[model samples]
Target: MPSISHKIQPCLWFDSQAEQAARYYTGIFPGSSISSVSLYTEAGQEIHGRPPGSVMVVAFELAGCRFTALNGGPIFKFTEAVSLIINCDNQDEIDYYWHHLGEGGDPAAQQCGWLKDKYGLSWQIVPAVISDMMRDTESGKAQRVMTALLRMRKIDFAELQRAYRG
Candidate 1:
């Protein structure tokens, strides 16, 4: 297969689990793999504080989207402000992601189909139908769908469809 290239990729910040996180993500998503890895050198020991040969960065692709994980110390942390969205085609796909990504995460953070993974990275496991429901501008179906969405942690596509019809 030809190599896939991306002009823009999201860089995830981690304290010391860049490689581990990359592996975990690749395992969860299909068509994913660790493309490359880079390690920190002793030349920047004073600034980086990490021992030489420690993992510095891992470039990975998940479901065809490229991402870079960097072990840049604990100066920054993942927040809910930015999240990756996984557009699922069915309830099975939604359930699979919710179970895997929501593992070891804060239960309270699971709302409106948004979940925090074990690595503290936020993800939105949304069904494709939600988009179609939300895009109906002529009818008030969009508002109804939003109301139904606001009431659940994990999205129920069937419920959203019912709401759209109402």
Candidate 2:
């Protein structure tokens, strides 16, 4: 186990892919890694109903944000109501994240830069400027940008810029 500093972090529930999910997430983001892993022992066999030494939880960090993935069974699942938002710097950044995160994900779940990864985790990949553009309602540029955004699955930063300019 590595030394932990974060007092609180998002805990993600998984049926059996806690370690795999942690590795996958850490691989995608720079300055990220798995810090620790705890395993179920014979002490909890009656309740956990698993072989001893099975993975129970995995602690990881993505771009400095800490998260915990638990093999807590399939009683719960990820829904679109909760999502991770990645605010990108440019079109290239957007494209890079979209490609890496959306790969092997459900195609039908993508809309307006939002996607569901293979793990059924929802994510919104968008240019940071989109927030500024969408907030500029005083000039009505926000409406134009929103209209352009509605038509996109993987947001095109260039297109949003054009809509904002108009």
Candidate 3:
């Protein structure tokens, strides 16, 4: 019997900039690269009537997760309802992603460990200790932390920690 791999790959739909986006992602993340790029062609013109040399699909990896970007011609657009969440160990990790993803991304306030990037993609830049902080049984403490988060565009971990203690 042969063993099957259970890796789940996410496919991203883009208008015409799939390759550029893939390159940007590869540059931002370590241990990432373009796995493959495919083009579309039509049978009558060339199979499905797609123009030759048009980008069909791009397979890439970021932080070891596989994602495919399809140049689907803008039929669908991304929304903030679904986003990639990053759990940061410290302020430095948070800052790096915040600067890059938020540079052109819109900022939305979510109670604890959530933000929306410009591409309408959601991201959660959460400190590793957030779970421990939220574990506090005291409702008041949790409320205070939530309050602090509501006031932030890019979350400040130190401030959240202070709120957690108060």
User: For each candidate, what TM-score against the reference?
Assistant: 0.94, 0.95, 0.82
User: How many clashing residue pairs are found in candidate 1?
Assistant: 0
Model 2, residue 29: what's the lDDT?
Answer: 94
Alpha carbon RMSD to native, model 2: 1.4
Which of the numbered candidates is closest to the native, going by highest lDDT?
A: 2
> What is candidate 2's lDDT per residue for 1-166, written digit by digit as tens?
3566888789999999999989998999988999889999999688888678889999888988999999988889999999999999998889888999899999999999999999999999999877788898989899999999999999998999999999
- What total of clashing residue pairs does each candidate reach? 0, 0, 5
Question: How displaced is residue 7 in candidate 1, in Å?
Answer: 1.2
For model 2 the local lDDT of residue 109 reads 99
Clash list (residue pairs), candidate 1: none
Query: Candidate 3, overall lDDT?
Result: 0.76
lDDT of each residue in 1-166, candidate 3, tens digit only: 4232536778888888888888877887778999889898764453344578788899888887888898877578887667787778888888897777666666443435566654555677878777777677666777787788878767799999899989
TM-score of 3: 0.82
> What are the RMSD figures for all models against the true structure?
2.1, 1.4, 3.5
lDDT against the true structure, each candidate = 0.91, 0.92, 0.76
